[model samples]
Target: MGQDQDTLSVVALCQSERVLWMPDGSPHSPRFKDRYRSRSGGLAQAMTVFLAGAGLPVGWRGRNRFSVLETGFGLGLNFLCTWAAWEADPQRCERLQFASVEAFPVSAADLVRSARNAGPEDQPECSIALRLPVLAEQLAQVWQGLSPGIHQWRFAGGRVQLTLAVGEVQATLQDLDCQADAVYLDGFSPALNPQMWSAQTLHLVAQHCRPGATLATYTVARSVRERLRQLGFSVEKCPGLPPKRDRLQAVLRP
Candidate 1:
């Protein structure tokens, strides 16, 4: 026997705080009983922490091209929400490109399953959840097989494209040539996933950011803030979503 082979699929579990989570593995979000994100931060993470932190739903209103780079794709809640927002905006950017890196790619079936277990309509985050099934179904139909390189998926007549780098964070981001307008930092906690939040990883992301690029994350760690500032970002501590004190948002200072 060489090594133990592990199979991947979407599984639901309950966290200590009563949040819902898919199985903790290569690319899925960590555990939170019912929330789409890790138990540490729920919808609050996406809306108040990530979105508000980056000044989204307001940042790329009239731009010609708007590109977002993300560290972990997870269940794709952030991507879906961003897409919905763009669709709803009359003066949205001309092209929306979201590029992300993931170590493991969940099966298409799991993606659809996640949509069913996601939140309802009234919630801000739920708007993305509701559309998950439709997108997931489409993705499932087209998801042939993922190799360890950049794979692009287009939707809405080429207005939107998701470029997924199916590999480790550092190398994957290094191989990408995108100049991001915004960054969504949705990796697991620094404590649990050091590689995702490591200085090296952040530096790679910062290198690809345009002069006025914005970044948002649910973490306010001193090290993270310092690193971002050193990378030419003006960091800010903003009011966080519930159950947490604060989140971090930053902009590249030309």
Candidate 2:
């Protein structure tokens, strides 16, 4: 932990962030020249690609505490959905920790708008969407405190925790000290945002994973799979949401 804190001391915070809105209500990143999340629906992508792929709800069930680490905190859709799921589940873990590293943090207004636009209307069956606005409001309330380095926020009467590392992905991941049970590899596509998926960055991610920790991502790019395998994760290509051919799911070998 001391080492991690030392790393955080030297890292820089995100700067000059902007999220562009499309006609269809999707958020696009002008810097990456790509959408913040899947056009099919951010909530849908979170459910199908990240939650289901990581065996969430079930994976976190019966555990005293579960942690999820994410590569990008774009709009925080994944975090909101996970928090809602934990709230609704009777068998949820007593504590949930979501840690994410972001080089660019969007404004509080953009976070709220992105979340409001990506709600139950996008996927009516998603119960999380029903409570999204309330949850997002809670998030926005504390969003202003977000600066560079590490900021921790507690919600759900302190049972849910968010540890946000606002800096470059590789450096931020190295500074994060948590044994994550699941991982969400979310960001722009590798072609557009290579730093988030680079071997060194992924290796830093692996260093924070407990044995048998699971990981999921919307991209099943061959290079990603190969790199993960070389790092000791059993990677597989899974069926993806509409307009996406496949997604990647991996588990660290014991």
Candidate 3:
């Protein structure tokens, strides 16, 4: 679609979700009744569950560019963590692209609050919190312009790029046309947010996966695993972060 047409089509905003800060400081979605990130903390979950599970840093090392597609943007913790990782790595890729879809975008204030609350105390090994506040501020500056369509932002001297599609899961995935090197399947639990884990939605996601692209998620739901398998991904269960038994990882087959 043309840029103007696409922008006009997305002018109608999806109602933003009400984000409630849990007693423990984690952000929770009232609509889904689910935590945005694990209680293990945003940075830790992004690293261990999404980055490590997808063999990031290592997978992207020496490459000219690396791109990741995420199902849910949430407070953008995953994007921040990934950007931090790329900046910290000595042999990082020349460019990092993070594309995500959020049906209900949260407010900029909530984004800042979420990062501040996700501190070292929540996950001691998570040093990314040190840079989160600044990164969050940068994201918040552009958050206000976000509409229902695709919004793009550049950071770190244009080394990092974030493309966010604000709309329904399936439609956004279908609208995106980029080859993903890694995919982070994060939203609510399958039982609570089934649309994000549905076979049809996953198939749309798979359409953007390049050969051998890796995928990871905090949930090891049988239905999710089966859907990935049917989509030609070699799915496997891996040891999860604290308080969680297992997480799912997979690689698209050539």
Candidate 4:
């Protein structure tokens, strides 16, 4: 345990996750030509597109452990929202494991900024408004010492843990050894970040999921739907939040 803690500081430096704050306060990825989340709010997207879509909170109830794997970490809004929801849920799983892969991770400051600027000024954050900033601070505290490898951190008295893989998506996912109960397929648009949404990447993602793992994503692209169908996922389009009309939800068949 001591050796493991010592190695957590062995992170080499790499710079990425460049963002241009849009006029509406959304983080825009110039490389991907897409916004991370809309001005509508990151929390809202996490709660609706991901948490609700995956049947979380309810899904994890009564389980001793639940894990979620994500294709793109982005600004980490989804993880935060999920953590907050788990804390609020009376019947949440005993342990919540979240693992995410990000080819280009943002600065620690950006992570906290993203959370602070979560929602529009007119509207408060979706839920956990009071706790969002606090959670962001906790994440930022350990955001330092990140490199092109896995950086695992324990939180909520070790009941909640985040495994952030900082490297190319495929290679990182290959290194990750977690059987996810749910999966979040999030990133820039399929057209923008082809690698993240590619068929081969999706295949690797499937390898990490247990049988009957649930999946949620904010895209209804026909190609994605077809590819997931081929992967033994019962895919369907569900009602989406704007600026999207429909979102995709899938369940891996046993």
Candidate 5:
């Protein structure tokens, strides 16, 4: 209904099928369908759609520094999952930097409530939620301190740097100095969230990618695949999670 400092309020159109609202603040995905507005892609969706699609865990094994850029920090599910994977992996990259952009941010209490509701079966999910003592508290404390620019938060001995870009998608992406090794495209679907998936936005993301950079999302729209191709990404269709037949994955080709 409205916008917050870092969380954008989006109405869930499909609840039975678990489709949440679309993502708005990032370009990694042309259109991010909630599939369950309440939880916004839940744990399975994120693990299958973005993480598996991008070839993570395995992808982060050897690199010294691994950077993941995401749009829509909703509930911080994707972020927590990614971080847990990194922490659990012995071969994980030495430095893990996760940068996400969101226009409306919810309160830390809300995040905790969401995670608790998500349940214990969601191991990494609940684990990350419970383990978030200092960082999560800091996030809650500074929820209202967000302004229209880049805000950096360091955690886990400063190895994890979360940069919140607080503005419109295009403007924020333009202002960030991020060259991502992996991009998590979690925007609302193009039909409902056009601005996030516009061709121009993809181009901007491409500009920030070094050759061979990878991108993944849960959308298989023709326009999205074509746009990514136009931006120098080699696109492919892969098996999606339950219900969805195919999702898109692309690699930046020099």
Candidate 6:
């Protein structure tokens, strides 16, 4: 955490959320009754499903600043992976702004552990796996004092910004002021976390996006696709990462 602003709540609310580690060492949400990321790997899912699906690294290339709006923060592996990718790319955008909303946030310790367990996406010796644990540590340090309702932090000499909105999906989305260049629509399964994928929620998400902005998600539910399509997004079902039959990508038509 480089710089943060507007402390609205205390860490006490963090107790309402509970997380359990799967036997495979992945983080699972007891409340959502789902794993935060694919058991195959967190970094892998972050890179392939969300980042690449949204055309990132490539999408952010040629911009002075890039904004990403993520529906589910989970263990924050996606933000860490995105930051790592930006740092590694020579043609990266000059600044990155990432805003994620989570109804229930896990402990800081889990963030680091999730990063450590997120692997085999690439070689452990020299890949994103090595970088995420260190990045997670930095995130955890800031997370220790985290409360709720819109907290902002800067990383990488202020080149990277994180706006963490903690609350229900729809309300938090409405509260966050972002004209996102890209979006990641991720959370528990639509069957389980229906509100996150509900029509009203997706409508609010679309309202925050810029014209021609791109969106991605790990789910390809029919209702989700239709809801997004109805919202004026050009939705496409794309090849997914392992364990997922298909993922979705979309663009907000101007």
RMSD of each: 6.2, 4.3, 4.2, 5.7, 7.0, 5.2
Candidate 3 lDDT over residue span 129-227, tens digit each: 777878999999988856677889899999999999988788788888779999999978999888789899999999999999999999999999999
Give model 1 RMSD, 1 decimal: 6.2
- Each candidate: what lDDT? 0.72, 0.87, 0.87, 0.85, 0.67, 0.85
TM-score of 5: 0.79
- Model 3: C-alpha RMSD to truth? 4.2
TM-score of each: 0.82, 0.93, 0.92, 0.92, 0.79, 0.92
Worst 10 residues of 4 by lDDT: 3-12
Error of 5 at 232 (Å): 0.9
lDDT of 6 by residue, 119-147 (tens): 87458675677899989999999985456
Give the true-structure RMSD of model 2. Answer: 4.3
**In candidate 1, what residue range of length 10 has the lowest lDDT sum?**
1-10
Give the per-residue Cα lDDT of candidate 1 at 205: 96
Off by more than 4 A, model 5: 1-41, 119-142
User: Number of clashes in every candidate structure?
Assistant: 6, 0, 0, 0, 24, 0
lDDT of 2 by residue, 14-60 (tens): 34377889988889987679999887888888888999999898999
For 36-144, candidate 5 gives per-residue lDDT tens digits of: 2213235566667777777888988888888898876756667766776677678888888888776545556655444444433536545544543434454566555
